[model samples]
Target: MNQLPTAPPVATAQVPPHLVDSTSRYVESGLRGAANTVRAYAGDWKRFNAWCTLNHLSALPASVEALAGFLTELADAGKKVATIQRHAAAITKAHELAGHDSPTADKKIKVLLKGIAREKKTRIKQAAAFTLATFKRTIQSMDVTTPTGLRNRALLLLGFTGAFRRSELEALNLEDLAFDEEGLIISLGKSKTNQLGQAEEKAIFYSPDSAVCPIRSLQAWLRVLGRTEGPIFVSLRKNQQLTARRMTTKYINLITQQYLGSGYTAHSLRASFVTVSKLNGADDSKVMNQTKHKTSAMIRRYTRLDNVRQHNSAKELGL
Candidate 1:
């Protein structure tokens, strides 16, 4: 009888140790929160780890005293109170993930944070809103002849009208846009408020004037781009040719600053929307629909700087 042919040995695939380690870190980071939040927490944890390594201490189960000392050193180094607080929160999260009690809750750590806040007089510097006049001037300054100009004009107009955060603006894709008789509808896949990947829609109504209309600007940009899919905003080469890569939030800030001058950031678009809308008599709930703000408190905060004088009871009292 003929013997059966010997079976060929099957090859076993082997994954490198480093890749496994990296994948674990990626998964852990994903579990924590949004990509930006994960990046920030990772950075904070790295700093804490470095400090521990320099002082010959264990970072995994850092002692309360050690954490307190770290905060003290950060304060002494002139780190912002908010920065220190974020660092402490990162450390606490790490310990919790490792199945250890959070050292950040120690009385000493709390006391140190309180002292730093008191010393620093921690006040958040809000981004100044771009008034309608300033926004119009900036738009007029843009040269829509070139691809970069068209993209920038569209970005600024859409960002302002939609009240989008920098990340939201940058995250936009061609698929997110839908045009109707009224104007355009943008579907936000995820945002700071909708972290669970829920779908949210923002409508951009058409303007009778073509000069300052976001919908028209966006249409012009898409027509020039000549593509049906992919990132809405991308980097432009020195020759003004569009690149396939998507732009970052940092770039958005730089672009806004470039056109609007100093003291304005990417957030200024959102703030300007809130301020202008409130000044135009749009109430909190109405603004919330455009901004996707979960609470009236945040809406008030955005409009507070501009509306303080207008909304004050003192004005009604003729003081």
Candidate 2:
């Protein structure tokens, strides 16, 4: 709703001697997070500020009672636990920027959130992950002769094997890739998880099957691209002419849904990577190496083995 500036002029408000140091610390760490997170904070804070205005309450220096009530309202409005939690974080960021003590630290706010999470189930809907069989089948159905088709094939294959987020797929440039004997190496400067812009690389090995191979598909697309350096994926005109404009993250979602059926989201590419890898007996460490997740817990979370019969040790035990 609101796009608050990531950085603002320092608040020159008077503060007590005891709080001055803590206030400075908060200011230094104000609103630091991943790009998507920061944007969410800005929008959520704007919505909170609007709500406070309607209720004639001060948004800045929010009281514990006010913060609790706002959070409760979000829950009542059917917002998921994750959304409510993010909203609270946004409010905290707002307070930090203003150099005010965040009411979110209060026990009342914390307990209120706990109660809301319990009352409303905390399980948010994850994207539906497809089997590798389905992935290959979908890839086979595409007509890569067209420029648009080639682009989609490259993105989908690369995204799945590399375990790339939609944002990362959209951010890919020609220079971000390096080809060698083994396969292609994708260099990522920044990503949803790797927000610090650390130098991260994901190795994509050549697939024995050239039809659904990421490296081969990418190379084929590049040959048609005829450009030394530029955005890898771009919008194409009706006549199959590629434009300088880059493909939007939303387009990535549409392309996935277009090929993989309406049931799957763009994230299915990455989620399926984890699910299929784990299904194939890949350990958490190996999956983490590809996904770049800091913890094994996250890799487990991304795994979509809904059927209890599959990957279960129950059947292996002596009955």
Candidate 3:
């Protein structure tokens, strides 16, 4: 294969030092994947490397048998099927980086994964969807007079209305927001699906009740922030003074649980958005527009239609 200046040498069998050096730069520059994806692979690869060391097997250019053994043991030890799949993906990525054929490509390895998945069910418990009544009740319960209350109220409302992932919400800044006569416009810089850095916008409107309006809640929070730039949702110090540091995803989960009680994560905000919106007759295309989902399949996955009475076509059959 002809080698591009940016790619590793293929014809010479041995890559030149100069070509390898340039390739290394792109590898470290997140050209291969997202920052979080890279970090996850790095962590999974580290554990695999350690396992190989303990078993005296070469992690790089790993044998199919060795890789299979490592994965089978992890499954036996009760690692979820999703996690096991990630470990395999990490191994494949590491092999590709080292210019070696990945052992994970073997048919035996694929069959093994399938067998393990069949033996161990792949069902995942999703976040519970909170209804509009429950959502209104919860928001009203929050005392928004205090700075902390304002921040939390804005975080929850905006998060739900925008259908934002906690990671996306945590990275939000005041500069990303645009306020106008209509409502609020958010210039989302990058998202999990929007990795190529295309321009993306999410619009939210005013609610009849000022208390539940995401725009008004966000504006109230901004008034407390006293600054137009920098991180919007920030960490609060002991005395409730805002810190410049951005909030973490874990804290977002904790905050969601704190307000909504157990059985909900920060993901519930996004899930409920899909559930409630779909129940309210928003079509797949419209929901996909706000959710930034490229496919209807994923929108279906995010929807938590647990209620027997909600969204049932059986009831509408006029029996």
Model 2 ranges off by over 4 Å: 5-30
TM-scores vs. true structure, each candidate: 0.86, 0.87, 0.88
lDDT tens digits by residue: candidate 3, 1-319: 0111122334434667568766566664443466567677888888888888899998887899999999999999999988999999988877776667899999999999999999997765678889989999999999987899999999999999999988899889989998999998899877788887799999999999998999999999999999979999999997999889999888989999999998899999999999999989999999988889999999999988878888788987877
lDDT for model 1, on a 0 to 1 scale? 0.83
Better of 1 and 3 by TM-score: 3
| Poorest lDDT segment (10 consecutive residues) of candidate 2 | 1-10
For candidate 1, list the clashing residue pairs, or say none.
none
Better of 1 and 3 by lDDT: 3
Best by TM-score: 3
Q: Compared with the true structure, what per-residue lDDT tens digits does model 1 show for residues 8-119?
A: 2222245465576565555454446665665677788888888888899888788987898888999899888778888898887776556568888778778888888999
Output the worst ten-in-a-row residue range by lDDT, candidate 1: 1-10
